[model samples]
Target chain A: DVKVTQSSRYLVKRTGEKVFLECVQDMDHENMFWYRQDPGLGLRLIYFSYDVKMKEKGDIPEGYSVSREKKERFSLILESASTNQTSMYLCAREVGANYGYTFGSGTRLTVV
Target chain B: DQQVKQNSPSLSVQEGRISILNCDYTNSMFDYFLWYKKYPAEGPTFLISISSIKDKNEDGRFTVFLNKSAKHLSLHIVPSQPGDSAVYFCAATDQTGANNLFFGTGTRLTVIP
Candidate 1:
């Protein structure tokens, strides 16, 4: 079955460390997104890629960057992790204009 | 500023009753609306969606209603079950079709037996 998979279910990192959250989709979707879910903030889009090597910043792109070198893989990088950045990171794939998203299980990253 | 908003932070409903979640958006350009359900420690899942042309869309026991004139939309869960309890997020996208969605703060629904 087609799915979006995250490399880690949970991660713990110290402050000032660089963290990478990986996502891969087998559906061959042209659009992939990264979001951070907080208690009251909901899902804030961090970044998205509409095609390979093409990326766009979302509402909350600060302290974060993305790499989409391949069609199936999208990686979210936190250059320097901080306690305030601790949140659940989600990856989603959109197939054309379907208007629905297939989301990964998510990675819960905790910065100490 | 937040383009989409869910005023209520939480809602409680009895099992077998209807649960209604409301969402409002300021962007008139948004033409597609969707609702998502999420449980703890898991990613949110797409529940239902409605286009701007239509007023309502139903799938199984879930239904979504859109009011373009009012810039509002709602999700109704009939005979809400315990398993249906989760955080529901409302999202919208405009005509650009770039797959960019603006999401609300989300409402946590609890079904009491």
Candidate 2:
């Protein structure tokens, strides 16, 4: 089975603080995604990387950025964290075009 | 605008009964549909999936039914158990392009013993 690991299981940051959420996949899947899970909003894609040094913005990418310097690791960056950014963040890797994504355990962020 | 929607926010079912979770999509271009189950403090896990060419797909106790005309899909879990309680989300994707999935809000299912 594919294992997607998040660097932090829980994080708390003050307003205006910079936040970094890291994700690493054991498998060699090319597609990696970041999503925020909010009540009543489901999982909204923040950003995705299809390859090393390549990235694309998703539906909701306003206050977030991503880095995929290497194939095995993908990171999400919040230049200035805010209360609204307090939500569960998930990392997922696409097994294939026609298959389901394998997700990490998730990181619960609390920006106060 | 939300392309996929799960109207019901929560559903309660008695143990040993049937639980049905419904989902609808506004995008007709979506050809692949998937269902995921999420427990508290964990990411969603893949449950089952169906393609546009088929109307029904089943795996053990979980079954998914799709209606192309209405752009609706449903998951049926027979003989519900307490362990089955979780938030269920339905996602759809158009395979023609990037295949990015649009997910529904999700329905929280609680099974009473």
Complex DockQ per candidate: 0.71, 0.72
Top model by TM-score, which number? 2
lDDT of 2 at B72: 97
What would the per-residue lDDT of candidate 1 be over residues B1-113, giving only the tens digit for each residue?
Answer: 99999999999999999999999999998888989999998988888899999999999999999989999999999989999999999998884756468889999999999
- Give the best candidate by lDDT: 2
How high is each candidate's interface RMSD, in Å?
A: 1.6, 1.5
- Model 2 TM-score relative to the real fold: 0.97
Using Cα atoms with residue i matched to residue i, what is each candidate's TM-score against the true structure? 0.96, 0.97
Which residue pairs collide, candidate 1?
none
